[model samples]
Target: MNAPPRIAAPTHAPEAPRLRPDRAEAGALTRLALPIIMARIGLTLMLVADNMIVGHFGAGPLAAFALGLMLVQTSQMLGLGLLMGSAVEMAAAFGRDALDEVGRIWRRALAYALAIGFAGAALSQAAPTIFLALGQEAALAASAGEIAALFGWSLPPVLVYVASIGLLEATGRPYVGVALLIAANLVNLGLGLLLGHGGLGLPALGAFGVTLATLIARITLAGGALAYILLLMPGRQALGRPRWSDHRWADGRRQRRIGYAEGLSLGIESGAFASMTLFAGWAGALQLAAYTISINLNMLMFMVAVGIGGAAAVRVSQARGRGDPAAMARSAATALLLYTGVMLVVGIAFLALPGVFAGFYTGEADLLAVTTPVVAGIGFLSLIDGAQRVVANILRGYGDTWLPTASHLFAYVAVMVPAGYLLALGLALGAGGLILAIALASVLATGLLLARLVQLKNRRS
Candidate 1:
């Protein structure tokens, strides 16, 4: 005998969605989007706080933190990008009343997360050598290596959080994930202040202290998210556990099929950004620290766009499964408009308060004097960068993955990397040159991805 359909709890009780998708185009998207946007911002803010704290420790500590992040974030993004398949797949399944498949997809995602996280941990050992080869100061690179190793150990928890959050979002439970992230941020803030400042009679851990905060927060997120998942899905809790009998290799392979394109896209984009970190290192430790601050501030705003994009992805996938082209277009359009509006406001803040934000990262007059302009540049760059990021995500929601991956390669590898290298080194353009290149890449990537979205919209219609 076959098992029963495994539909989990809907936003309401366990009932079919009344089949009313008319308003889901805009209203529903916004509803799903708010909590997700807040969650993304929350996570980014926590990291920004860490940067602010470490920046005050001194330029050297900030530089070490930047160098360490160069490796950890790139790898983490790659793994998380790959796991986005879980969201897309589960959303489709949930829409089509194949909720049991959502559980299968979740399990596969967890498996991939653990495997990828451990691999990244092992690979992080090479960060020091990579930084040195990229022309970083030997001392800064060595210190960064230690921090990177600690960050590597923290990835398993981070990946678990990613997996759990994706599952929750896919199942129309983003609020739970948001709540978990908020709780984790509170834990992180307390620990960050405590361990970071050596408040309890311990010596200051400097950059290492920031990393400790990250580890503790990540553990809190994973543990909390898992408990939530179990509470919401009591019957399938056994299947959610990682067991040979519960999950199959075939399911893992199926998920990876969709994920590889996203992974490539993220790797291309992140690799280009990481190279900018190297370019800053070439300038000196001070420049690297300043660059990190500017990038961190820019990314915090970018998270708003990412959250909107992720929400759009879920809505689009569901609309597609339900065979509703109009709803899909509406979701995409609404996401673009909302993300643009928020990012524009963020750009204005960056323009108006560049020095204020720079001061948040550091109070040092010397660092602030030089960092202000860089932070201002980030404000300018945030416009196109945020646009491209969300547009790419929107396309992914339409199940157009490979094109986005190819576009990123062209934008990052072909456009940004070469221009950044030539303008920064050959012409001595410094950080300005690199950011200008980033702007170009964002433009290229946005154009390509938007073209794909247009084509998809037309085809679907």
Candidate 2:
């Protein structure tokens, strides 16, 4: 009886072990990344489709399209960079349980978006002048300028869509943006054909027609994204209604500061590539078309990194909001890991099937000959280019901005530009030389970013 009583001493079960933070972050990052990746890919597809349509029109139109894109895309990146702060700030707010701040941040971002869009539109109107000033052939400059003007008006809608998507992504509603992008692409394709080829009693717009189609599709996308944010998103409840009262100067300043650095960084990088495009142009219309196609394909792959980097940004921002440095480190590491694996597969495919990939964009035998090798160059370029993108975004998440911007300036402007000139012109490497220059710059930028991230981690520790 005594032994039984002793055995009856209270025994409590051990509590379930807590889930590892890194593992939880891995799951969250994956869930967040997949849809964003799809959305990013969808965004790239818009350009791909536009290029293919323009390519079929003729090499001259294709060259003009590429030239127009040099301005349009650089401005687009600048706008996106400025708005990127919305996602970081809102995600941080959500992580720290400051839910109300999320909505306010978005409102401020929207205002900035509209202002930036209008400014970009005005800037785009001068593309022809800019091209001529940059030594582009007069005829080519005029054609490209026309295309640029048509594409320029699309900026407001594009920026609005970007800002809205940022809100949706941070709030765990990324799928909506992906769906909207899908719809936008469909609209673009249908209209692009009708306008581009002049069908259904509609006058063929040529390159301008295709560009106008993009403009219309962008407007549709923006409207849909904004509507969802206002009417359907559950997170909108937390984000609150669009209220003017929410506009506070201090808050807007903080958000804009983030954008300033990122915008400048993106401007530098995009401008550098645009300079390379100019180099290709000097090589001839064929080289320009080849460079354009190769870069677009590489950009498609780069979007994979952007998607993962986006998820990492949210995760790191949230961790920062929670004042947890370790979590931030882990989240970044996880993102890099995912990007590495995905890019590895993509790189291998590019190397193995460069010809097939090149075929999809153009039917010209000469164009394919130039494009295929450049596509293969993308195999190695993707890894370094994508790594830099991910690391830069991670640093942005931590609010460490200007340094990254400086690094980009040095790498792209200082290193890549001259290297591109030397390799493409002096060495007479043409399109392939341009690719090599880009790869070199990307490697430098990636290393700088990684070291910066490591420094931040060590300081935190």
Give Cα-based local distance difference scores for all models: 0.80, 0.86
Q: Find the candidate with the highest TM-score and give its number.
A: 2
Candidate 1 lDDT, 151-263, residue by residue in tens: 88778888888888877776667778788888888888888878888877887777788789888898888988888787765455433445565367766665777888888
- As for candidate 1, its clashing pairs are none
lDDT digits (tens) for residues 176-282 of candidate 2: 89999999999999999899999888999888999999999999999999898888777467766677788878767777777788888888888898899999888
Error of 2 at 331 (Å): 3.2
